[model samples]
Target: MKRQFKKHFSHNSELKCFFYRLHFHYDFYKKWGSTTPISLSFWVFTFHVRENICNLTLKGSVTVKIISVTRIIDDMGRIVLPSNARKALNLEEDYLIMRIDNKKHHIKFSSSGRGKEVPIDESGRIPISPDYMNKLGWETGTEIGLFMQGEEGVLQGNAPSCVICGSNQALLLVKKTHVCEDCIHTGTEASAEKWSAVLNDLFQEYKQYCEAAVTFTNTEDVHKARTKGRRLRTLIQFIGIKKEHPLYKCLKEAHDILGKVREDDVFIDAFDKEAENNQYSELYRKFIQKAEEEREEHRNELKQKLPHIIDDEFSARWKTFSQDELKDCVYKLDIETALQKYEKEFSERVIKYQKIKDKKSDKGLDSLHSVRKKAKKLRYIYNFLDLVQSIDYSRKSRQYKKIQKDYGDIIDLRDWINETGSLGEDIQDDHDDVKKVRKQLNQRLKRLVKQVEL
Candidate 1:
């Protein structure tokens, strides 16, 4: 494969560029399945049909190889791009990529939406975003006709659209398209003020959740408060806020503190219901009481978070996020475009979950739990795009929800059993209780797998 790859560049002057990166890990890359790195286009060039490797420059538009190169991060977290590759790729001394603002464009392509700003170095070569190009089905050796737009080196609103998506928002035009940041980049960027207001309100509510920690009357409020705390934490992360700052740590600690309370509450609810009308209600009464006691003990643990959550410093930091201005509202992604970009992710997750379904072992169950959480994220993006209204959405939703519910039940029962052991109150015949629940869980999971038909 090295000889094969080397031969392609053997006669080309750019052989030095190709050999430096690929030779470093030739065997590893050959084993790659669906997962590709940042530089998808160049590898894609290598993957293209030889017969289709031709480019027709529109006027002066020159297409070029936008190969992806992954740099290893040292222990100190620094990446060094080699000089030969940089020169060959026309990279700048200090590369800067300011995110593209979709709101600035008067006429926006609502279909494709927004994406990341293409990084332009001090040197003039623009790194092509392969997302749309791949969508356009271009090969690696495709020639990109390079052209300058506007006068005085100031690219005007007439900046070339992405070579792929045709979005004129930022400088993503490798002569035309912006580099793809993943399927999530495109979508809404309506008004910065509204985003700020919404974030402010959410942050305020998060603070309220912390304030009401002691007053929460039931598991529902506790669940919602925990969910809100997590959502607030993720909102800033999605917006690329100052991540390492104390504010992120506060949000993380707040959610983590609530996480225990929520987990215990879920176990209590699951067990209490199972025991409610059972013939052995009398026998299970003590177990229910034990569960409730455990939940309360964890709830009291929230007191530890009060000082940090209630402090003005923490409140002020969150308020700063609310003040951020996002001109565009990135709420919708192009469904077809997104599917093309994320199909590999969507496929591999399903495959992974399938491989773990029958393994009732502890480690397997832990992995299954992680997969369910990830499935929820996939569902979120699909629904956010309103892909739910599509023809097959209902079936797809059904298959995953069934799988998630089964795993949820198994996890709940497992946690309940674990919690029983830790509650310090001896429940007689605990083995019988766990065995009964495990048998039922196994039966339900089998049925769910059949229904999913995967």
Candidate 2:
């Protein structure tokens, strides 16, 4: 009777050669006899197979073991075989058979045979089937160990480690890269450093604007300085700087001084436009002259006060203060908490304003103004987070911008009426003209209020 034989190899640690193990089975009964000695050749070594085992002696000591390879599963659950392994297996075909052995707890890959055919991608990566991954409880960023068998490859699971710091504890898979919690905390510290640098640049910009305003270099410089001061104050508060901090107080004082100048500038510009009309030319002329005088007074105040506020000592102090405050500020946690708090407050304010509007009360204007300021605060906070941390809030910021513009127009007209009304009381002669201008502005304000949404 013929006997069947299956070939296997075992490593000889001392001799550095493979010893072939043969098994006689019933499946090879038609191909070989029970007593036949089979001749086999493998890589310059010749061997005669006996009953159940055979050992071939090499002419020289040769190492033939293929080194194991390690690879990380990418976000898409794909793994790449090393070039050497690919060459050794002669894996030239575009398709391979993948077999999962639950009993052996490993996956087997062969160039051909009966199994599920998986395509080798153009980049030479094989995507592990989702079903197989689910069965093995594997996820993206899992480490895999690959070793070559006779003409096949075996894949075994490995313990995952952080790609950034090689930490095995508290690993998080983010965008196919394993990151440990310690690295995340370090990243936050790095972010704080970045914010400190940005704040230093902002302080310098504020100083430049103040210089331009003080020198009267540009009429618009007053507005620019005020804006920069406001931004600085907002940033300082958000970064956990105390309101009593000298830097905050200095910025607030400068902001208030510039704000007065900006108000006069706005009034002067409005008067100049109104003076172009034949009907209100005399009234606007008088208003324009008074506004220009007040503007000069405010400008003089700014020239004196701003220089002292933004002098050399301010810069040096800001440099030291920003570094110290940012180091201790948990800005990441603060931003998230602030976002939630501001959003809730904004929503409540909107609802309250809506109720006030329903009553047709003049107080609705004040309530709406409160809502506008809340929106502005939310917008500023959103913008700050987006700029420093790359968190996206562009949509909310745009929505708030529209709200501020719509409400700001009404507020400006109301302020103009009050200013002219007060000036008319002082003059006592142009009271009728002031009343007419206030009437016209009231009509415009009503029209604008009608157009407002929420």
Candidate 3:
């Protein structure tokens, strides 16, 4: 009977008969006699029947070497390899090499002379060490499909999940790990806390700078204080503080006062450098003395007002606002929406400036200055978002920074020309040197205007 069966049964027909017999617990001929089809676990029964039939027909001959098993990853991220599988594969080495197939969503383990060694314990358990687990982004309680192919064991993760929260919904692959949007929101909350810390630190530094400016006679101190004040004000606006807020008003007043002193210092420095040339020596000296006197007057005004601007009451208000109001605002802020709003504002400003530039009117210098200020604010906001939200806007930030610098140079040249004109009337020598410098500045300004794009 066995010989007749082996001789007459086609390979596929014999397998079908074998499957029916296994599913119905009947002899192959009897099961084949019935026409009813029986369904079973396809993969499990197919592989099992193939292995059994091969062993029976071939008398323990090897046709195909394979094994399949399902294993649960324990808390320690360890899985037991059955003795039969290990023996069949001749997996006697203490270590195996692991390879990941991200495309197929499976991992393969084999014996190798190279690569990192994954250890198998004495009880036939393979412990996926911490490093390997992290590399695979697998966590405890993950089910893995284990199967053998030739001398290699393959593992497949059962389902994708959020690495942070184990959520299966809305999973996003990030650097070989899955993340869900809910966890991303939680991350944003954590970032808000970090931003609060950063804000507090900045406020403290600004106070320190204000103190240094008032206590010291150095012009650099005033410059540092004003810069810090501008940064704080930018942050304040980003946090959605109204301009009518006392905090904004206070900072703006102080910033404006310091700007006067800083401007005089800049003028004096320019004059000193120009005075090195004997042609403008007397005129430069006179202007330098006048700038020094004005700077002292502004400095005294700043010293009187600085202590009042960021006093204890203001500090208390800031702490209250940052902890209570600012925290909530920042946490609830949709970063995408904020970015869009700023971008829209910037686009509008660019359009306005472009129209003004096209008209070639001096009346638009104020509009040009507005565009420059808007670009600077946008650049600062981009940097702020990067630090607080981990968004990569560095390219946009760099772009806007260049815009700010270019416009700033034009404004500075314009101011210098105006100042030179004012001072040149007092110099009697036909004003040739002044005209030459002014002409050079005007030419450079025109070139810069031409190079600038909307």
In order of appearance, the predictions have TM-scores of 0.50, 0.61, 0.56
Candidate 1 error regions (>4 Å)? 1-190, 241-245, 324-346, 379-407, 420-425, 428-454
What TM-score does model 2 achieve against the real structure? 0.61
The candidate, 1 or 2, that scores higher on TM-score is: 2
Superposed Cα deviation of residue 307, candidate 2 (Å): 1.8
List the candidate numbers ranked by TM-score, top first: 2, 3, 1
List model 1 lDDT by residue over 1-454, tens digit each: 4555555445444433534543232332343423544233344222111101111122123243232323332333223333433444343334423222234421111111244344334433344344433443433444322222221011112333332233333232222333322211321111233345556676677666667766766556567667666665555544444568577787777777788888867766666676777755544566667767766777677766655665798867655544432332123212344454454664676577678645556665666676666555444434322221212354455555666665676566556655655552466656565455545546665454355433
Q: How do the candidates rank by lDDT, highest first?
A: 3, 2, 1
lDDT of each: 0.46, 0.67, 0.67
lDDT of 3 by residue, 1-454 (tens): 3443333333345444654443222242243324424222222132322223222323433334345566888988899887766776676678678766667756777776444577888888887767657766778887776766466667776545544445655444332334455654444444455578778888898888888888766768888888888888998887678899988998999899888888877788876887897565776686677567767898889889879887998899898887777756665454555668888888887788777734224656667877888888888878765554323567888988998987887776667677778766765774787687667767877777777667
| TM-score of candidate 3 against the unseen true structure | 0.56
- For 1-454, candidate 2 gives per-residue lDDT tens digits of 2111112222223112222222222332223323334222221011111100111101111114333557788999999976666776777688778989998777888887777888887677988999888888778998887766346777778544544345656544343234455655554454555566667777778888889988876778888788778877877776567889998898888888898888888888887987897597888888878878778898898888888888889887887787666666643234544567778888898898777643223687778888988887767766665555433567888888789887898878877877887666665578787888888988888888788788
- Give the poorly placed runs of model 2, Cα more than 4 Å off: 1-160, 169-182, 330-332, 358-362
Q: In terms of TM-score, which candidate is strongest?
A: 2
